[model samples]
Each structure stands twice: as structure tokens, then as C-alpha cells.
Target: MDTQVIVLSVVADIVGLVSVILGFVAEKTKIKPSEIIVNDFVYCDYPTSSVLGMAISASLMLILAEVLIAIAGSCCGCCRTNAAGTGKSVVGIVLSVFSWFAFTTSFILFLVGAVNRGVNWQHLKIGDDCPLSSHLPGIFAGAAVLAFVAVSLGTAAAFLLAATPGSSSQYAQGVEMGRPQFQVPSNGTPPFNRPTI
Candidate 1:
């Protein structure tokens, strides 16, 4: 494997782990039923839980890791556009885009799950529900898993892009539409032909 790939993988792993940790912490720190005051309206206690910060931090970490990996992988002409690299680039781009989508979903989930953790508006009856906002721990856990998946996919895509041909650092397919050409050596004699008297 390429050193660049190894480095990128390591960075992604670290970032992913950090995000996962934050997510789990968010889950743990979420508002509990005991912490809620019930009467007519519902609101969190003073100071609130730390879930909001954790969730938002996790989301930010994921985005930062994605951008850093992408920038580090192909910044040196490793992602040049050429026919020789079309297939690889397409697949790589697809994976990268999917990764982005996954992380985006996770970010939204995290945001939603944490948005209500600090609700202080005590005028919402919420249709006889005292919980006001009910967020399951599964939501935070699932979002963390998704963030990990996104990191893995993004690393794979960057590796593929680095492996593509025609990069300034890698072999080029030549100037002919960036396609490889094969030429047989000609010594004025046919390779498989013999003169018959």
C-alpha cells in the first residue's frame, strides 16, 4: 500500500474514533426523565446537558476529516482528469459522494437529537406529553456508526483517486487522448514470417 494511503487511513481512523466517542458521550449525557420537571409545560434543568456540544462537535469533526483527507490525497496532481483515469475517478467520486451523503445524514441526526436537549421554553404543552422531546439513545449511537462508515468510505475513495494513472507522480498514458499505446519493434524483418524458396 502507498504511504499516502496509510497516512490518510490513520488520520481518518483517529477522526472517526473521536467522533464516535463524542456521539456515545452525547447519548450518555442526554436529558433523562428524572431531570425533567412536569406540571403543564416541560423544560430542561438549569445549565442543561452537555449533549448539545458533543453532538455538534462530532458533526464538525466528521466534516473536517473528510475535507482534510480529500485535500491531502490528491493535491499533487493525483486526481488529474484523463481518459486513463476515467473509470477509477468515477468509482472514487461515487464512493466519496456516498460518504459525504452518509455523514450529512449523521450530522442532521446529531443536530436534531441535540437541538432539544437544552429547551428552556416552558410554554409548550406538546399535546399532553410531558417529555416535550423524546430522543432515543439509538439515534446518537446510529449516527456515530454512520460517521465511522463515512470516514472509511472517504478514505477508500481517496486511495482510489491516488491510484489513478496519468498523475504527474504516476505513469502517464501518453499524449494520445491519454491512452496507452503498444508498438512492436521493427528490424526490417517480420516477427513470424519466413522467406520460402
Candidate 2:
């Protein structure tokens, strides 16, 4: 294993252990409940087909990010002397920042909620007094910022790797061999020749 991967594995294991411990503590203390109430649950409503379409879109984005990260890291070359090593470092830093943001944000949200005595997410018709807490907005905003930073770094790393001549040729060749090709008509004819476009 490369030094970076070893380091990351250790860090991830530590974080996971800490998270598990804290989770158990929270569960025992009854500070953070995990139950979800469906009565007041609200999600974006759309046509039935829209659900699958959106899911596929989201899945593609996630997969693209993961694949790009892997490519960048591997291209970085054993974390010893490759430029791809820098990419791995960037990804690691981004994740660390995100984890820190999440931890702090959750702590603040918990404090704000406990002090205010104003819980959110009330069951409207059920008359249950579950007021949607104010902390959720901050938590979501923090998470969004973190996600954007991580994705931006990942994209930049991928672009850098692809733009380099050596890796670019390899990636292009791989894609060419793996992806199906089709020709488009010069005239305005149907393009079923193109996959399910």
C-alpha cells in the first residue's frame, strides 16, 4: 500500500471508531434521536418516472466523482513521487475539512436546539408540537459548502490528470475502447444511432 493510502486508512479507521463511540454515547444519553416521523415528512413531489430519472442522475454524479478520485489517486503513483500524489493530498484535505465542518455544525445545532426549546418538524394535522428546528438550515448550509469544496477539488484533480499528455492518452484510449460509438447524420435525421438519446 502507498503511504498515503496507509495514512488515510488509519485516519479513516480512527474517525470511524470515534464516530461509533460518540454515536453510542448519544444514543444512550437520548440527546439525538434517530426515529423518523413520516406524518410531517415532506419531499419533493413529482411524476412517477421522475423519481427514477433523478435517482439515476444523482447516482451518475456520485459515481463520476468516485471514479475520478480513484483515477487521480492512482495516477499520483504510489504517493511517492507522482503528481497524482498531490491529487490524493488535495482529496484528503478536502475530506478532513468536511469532517471538521460536520462535527462542529452538528455540535452547534444540538446546542441551539436544546437551548431554544423550539423543536421543528411538527406533525401539522396530528397536532404534535414538532417545530422544525432552526439548526437544520445551518447544518444543511455547512454540508452543502463542504460538498461543493470536495467536488470542486475532485473535478480539478481529474482535469489536471486528463490534461497531462501521458495520462490523457491512456484515459482517452480506455474510454474509446470501452464506450460504444455512433455516427450522426449530416441532414436532420433521427439520431437513434446515438444510444437512448
Candidate 3:
């Protein structure tokens, strides 16, 4: 059960981290091409809708990550049997959960940044009326990268400790093979009467 929990936690952290990275990438790099208008038209200044959408999504994800980390840090304590062990477990759980959040956020942002999956960049043109600056995507993308680092490294460390061998583990405690010995033999001829079992 403990192993399973650790594994799940690690997996979650990774997923979250991946999400965060993708989010950041979507925000930073212009993977999607900006649509070109055929003729000169009345263009309004506006933030790239797709970027804006992704940013908003990433922000929400960031917030969620914080909450999950908090929860993992606290809840993970219950799984530990010792003070030091508890602390380590908490750290591990927190990191794993954080990674998952980061990964998930990044992946979502990436998906959002995708031309068809997310906001349509074609509707947003250069020098158009937009609410956000053109550079916001890059900023979010950077944040996502940071999140990935935190989550991946942290979770990995936690999992390593969790996987450590211990006395309590079944593998470390195997069945005894030696036979039991008796203090005295059942047959005794020296005492006059012999008894046998």
C-alpha cells in the first residue's frame, strides 16, 4: 500500500509538471503562426486571444498546483510512522504532487496554444486592440519551466527514499528455513526408564 501510494504520488507529480512546462512553452514561443490579413483593415490593439486564454488557464493551474502541494504536504504526513519519516514522506508527496500539477499545467497550456485546440490566433492580428501584451506568453512559458524543475526533482527524491529497503518490507523479511531444536531427546536410557514420544 505504501509503495502504491508513493508511485501514484510520483506519477501525479510528473503529470502536473509536464502540464506546467507545456503551458510555459505555449506562452513563450509562437508555435502557431499569426494569421495574415489580405487587405489593410481597421485593426484594433488587443492581446493575442489564444495567449490570453492560455495565460488565464495557466494561472488557474498554478493556483491549483499550490493548493495541491499544500494538501499533499499535509495529507502525506498521515502515511508516515516517525517524525523524520513523516517529514521525508511529506516532502516526497508534496514534490510528486507539485510535479504532476506543473506537468499538467504545461501540457494544458501547450494544448491551448495549439491553433485549433485553444483560442484562435487568426482572429487576433498584429497591432490590434487587445488587452494583454504580446510578450505574456513567453513569461508564462518560463514560469511553467520552473514549475517542471521543482516538481520533477522533488518527486524523484521522495520516490527514491520511498523505494529504499527497510526491515519491515516483505522482501527484507523472508521465511525462516532452519529447523527448531529440542532441549532434550525423547528417548532416555540413562535414568533407568526410557521414554519415547
Candidate 4:
């Protein structure tokens, strides 16, 4: 594997780990509940648990993919030539691609959820008879940002792995068959003596 590819894999792994941690934090952090009383009825606004759960699941998948890639890259010797090693790397790339999709979806969902929650809070404050204010915790926003970054890094790593040069079996076979790998210069174009036609 190329050094650049290795570097990319490492970066992806680090980002993935960070995203997982942030997702966990977001899941644990809860929005402060506030009540509004109107016409002798009480209403409370709470954070969306389902969205945070999805974020955690997606982040976990990203972490799994990144860890797998890092392990394969470290253990697979001469990935270009060894069929098993090459296959392992290919699997890693596929996992990374899946992780990218998951991360992207998670990020979008989190963002939309946060925005909607904010809008609802604003509407409650301005339009409702009983003014109430509640917003998502900062941890959720941080997790969304981390998930987005993880997607970018994971995608880059996958592309780098896919672009790695594979061993050329045909070139080796040609060399074994005593075939010139490159065209030799003609006598007229070289510094050697040329025979008369």
C-alpha cells in the first residue's frame, strides 16, 4: 500500500472514533424539559430520542468500518500481489463506502431534527399562548458535525485504497517469455553502427 493510502486510513480511523464518542455523548445528553400551561392544560417539549439513536448507530458503523480497514491495512502484507490480502483491502473499501452513506444520512437527519426542534421552540415562544423555550443539547450538534467530517474522511480513504496499484501479472508473464518490455531504439536513431540496406 502507498504511504498516502495508509495516512488516509489512519485519518479516517481517528475521525471515526471521534464521531462514535460524540454520538454516545449526544445520546446520553438530554434536552431540558420545560412545561407550558394553557387553558388548564400542560404541555412539555422533549428532545427527539429516535434521531439520537440513529446517530449513535451510524457512528458505530463508521467506527467498525474504519477499524476493519486499519486492521486489514496493517495485517495484509504486499496487498498488491497477495490475492487474499487484496481481497481483504477490497472488503475494507466496501465497508468504508457503506460507512460513508450511513454517516451522511445520520448527519442530515440530525441537522434536520435540530432545525425542526429549534423552529418548534421558536413557534412555542412566539405563537403559542403559553410561551415555552427548549432546544437540543449542544452535544447533538457536535455529534452531527463529527459525523459529517467522518463521512468525508472515510470516503477519501476508500478512494485512496481503490486507487492503489495492483501487481501486473501480464507484465511478469511477458518478462518470463523473454519479450522486450519496451521498444528498443533503431540503429539509425541510436549511437550504434547501421548496416547498409
Candidate 5:
């Protein structure tokens, strides 16, 4: 329920969404196999697709969202004794790890996908007929899905980190035993207003 965590979570969610949208744009705008022209062993004619810019932008936003989530959640340390909050929970740790893994995979895919979209020519030519598009549409869509998954997991972990119910918080609540009251009650007049012990 902390304000900082809430704000960070919201921002991360927004950035993640934008990243996803941009990824979709890149997927849609990617260069098609039909568009690639083989120039008779000279050089392939690859259109200047918008996929590079969109994919890079998406990658950046995704990184920003992950960074924000990290700030909100602190670090993942499941070994800590406080399982209820901030870096000490098993679920949080799992979520964080999964998120990071997904982010890494997604980022690489985005870059590779951008490159595959004729943004960069065939690095190594093997029978060189536009170097096989490698199903660009599917790759981009998969990357976007991975990005969504990463953000989702990270957000869950951040909420867990913000739970705020750990050993320290419990200790601050003090003991449950009742103490003798020195003040007189409204319904009764005490012999003295001060404690004797």
C-alpha cells in the first residue's frame, strides 16, 4: 500500500504497454519476403523497413519498465528471513528471475528481428535468397508476448515486495499483554492518577 510502490507499478505498467504496442507496429511493418529483390549475385535489394526503429524503441521501453519494477521491488533475495515483503519471498524471487530471463530473451529477439527485417543485410550468405525471412511476423509477435510476460511477472513480484508485513513490522506492533492504566477512567474515580509500581 506504499505510495512509492504504487506509483512505480503504474509507470512500469504503462511503459510495458507502450513497448508492446511498438512491438506490434514493428511486426506489422516488417519487411516481407516478397519485397526482397535478388539482384543477380550482386546484392539483395532490401527495403528500408520501419522495423528497426520500432523494435529498438520497444526494447528501450521494456528496459525502462523492468528498471522501474526493480526499483520498486528492490532486489530478489529469497534467502532473507522476512518472507512477507521486499526481496525475501520465494514467489517474489521466482517472479523476478523469470521476468529477467524473459526480458533478456525478448530483447535479443527484438534486435535479431529488427536485423532480420532487412535492416541489416545477410551477415553470412548461405544460398542467399533474401536469407530466409525466418517467419518475421511470428518472431516479433512472440517477442511482444515475452515482453508482456516479463512485465506481468515483475509487477507481481513488486506487489509482493510492497506487502510491508515482515518481522520488523510485527515487532513494532509490540506485545499483546495489557498494562496497568494510571489515568482515571470516565466511569470510575481511581485512588491515584499515577502508578505505584
Candidate 6:
């Protein structure tokens, strides 16, 4: 319900959506094979698919969590006392953290794989020029950027939700309702008076 939470949720959701789109695009891009013919055998080079799969999975999880958080916040008045709403927020936070970890890991793996592939290609002694193109790498690079942005925004939203006052405690509503104050006796003595000193 807080303005900060709403803004963060929207930003995170948008970023996550973009990340998902980019990840899908990267996955769909065709990786041209570089074939090497030596004697009578031919070797083909193809990009690793695990990196793209991880990126897509991470983006999907982030977007899903963001949507659930937004729905719970809107429908439940962001009430901490609402068990279902609180649970959704907690789940969103956990999912966001997992997405971040997945994105980071995939990004690292993608970069390493790219570097290794390049190094290997350079070492190949082929009679003809390599036919490999940089298009797939470029697409993957874009996806990596999108994933990083989504991870950053999602993390920010998760932290904001966790820090929101009264967001995790059921007794917060009672405290917000204000507690009763006790009045002191005008005689400056205890209400249940003891023997005079």
C-alpha cells in the first residue's frame, strides 16, 4: 500500500517482463555451426543451451513473483494480519532471491562459455575460414544485460517489502490501534495502598 512499495513493485515487474522477453529471444536465436573437416571426419561447434534455459527460468520466476506480490498488495490492502497476503509477500521475496542467484550464475556461465568457445575456435586449424557468426553471442549478451537489470530491480523490491512496517507481524495491527495509558493516583500512592511508611 505504501507509495515506495508500489513504485518498486511496478519497476521490478517491468524489468522482469523485459528480461523474460530478451531471454526468449536469446533462446530462439539460431546459432550457426562452424564445421571443421579433417581427413574424412567433420566436427561441428554449437552454443550451450543450459545458459539460455537458466536465464529463461530465472526471468520467469522473477516475473511470476512480482505479479503475485502486486495482486496480494492490491487485493488485501497490504494488511500484515492477512495470512495469505503476508505469505505471498514472503514467497515473493524468496522467489526474487532465487531468481537473482540463478541469473547471476547463468550470466557467469554464459560469459565463461563464450570465452572458452572463442579460445577453442582460434586454436582450430581448418583449411577454410570459420563460418561462425557473432549474432547469437550478441543476442545472449543482450539477454544477460536484461537479466542483470531484472535481478537488481527484483532485489530492491524484495528488500522494500521486507522492510515495510507491520508487514511481517500479526500483532502490528493491535499496536497501531494504540494502547491504553494508566493514570497515576493524585495522592502519589499506589492504587492498592500498603501500610503507611
Query: Which candidate, 1 or 2, would have the higher lDDT against the true structure?
Result: 1
Task: Report lDDT (CA) for all predictions.
Answer: 0.71, 0.37, 0.48, 0.50, 0.77, 0.50
For 38-90, candidate 5 gives per-residue lDDT tens digits of 66565666777778888889999999999999887766433223554444366
Q: What is the lDDT for 182 in model 4? A: 56
Candidate 4: clashing pairs of residues: none
Tell me the TM-score of each prediction against the true structure: 0.69, 0.29, 0.42, 0.39, 0.72, 0.37
Q: Among all windows of ten consecutive residues in candidate 1, which has the lowest summed lDDT?
A: 75-84
In each prediction, how many residue pairs overlap at the backbone (N, C-alpha, C within less than 3 A)?
A: 0, 9, 40, 0, 0, 0
Alpha carbon lDDT at 38, candidate 4:
33
Model 2 agreement with the true structure over 56-150: per-residue lDDT tens digits: 23223333444445444443322323233355455544544454444344344334423322223333322343334422333323322433444
lDDT of 1 by residue, 108-158 (tens): 888888775664534444555544345565789889988888888888777
Among the numbered candidates, top lDDT falls to: 5
Candidate 6's residue-wise lDDT over 1-197, tens digit each? 45555565666666565655555554454344533333333443444444444444544655564455444343223444443445546665555555556556545534443443322233343455444444345555555555656455455545545555556544643455558666779978766667878
Q: lDDT, candidate 6, residue 73?
A: 45
Q: On a 0 to 1 TM-score scale, where does candidate 2 land against the true structure?
A: 0.29
In model 6, the clashing pairs are: none
Return the candidate ranking by TM-score, descending. 5, 1, 3, 4, 6, 2
Indicate the residue-level lDDT of 157 in model 1.
Answer: 79
On TM-score, who's better, 2 or 4?
4
Query: Predicted candidate 5: what Cα RMSD to the true structure?
Result: 11.1
RMSD of 2: 16.9
- Which of 1 and 4 is the better model by TM-score? 1
lDDT of 5 at 26: 81
Q: Write the per-residue lDDT of candidate 3 for residues 5-80, one digit (tens) a residue.
A: 4655555575565557556555554433343332345543222345555555555555554445434333433333
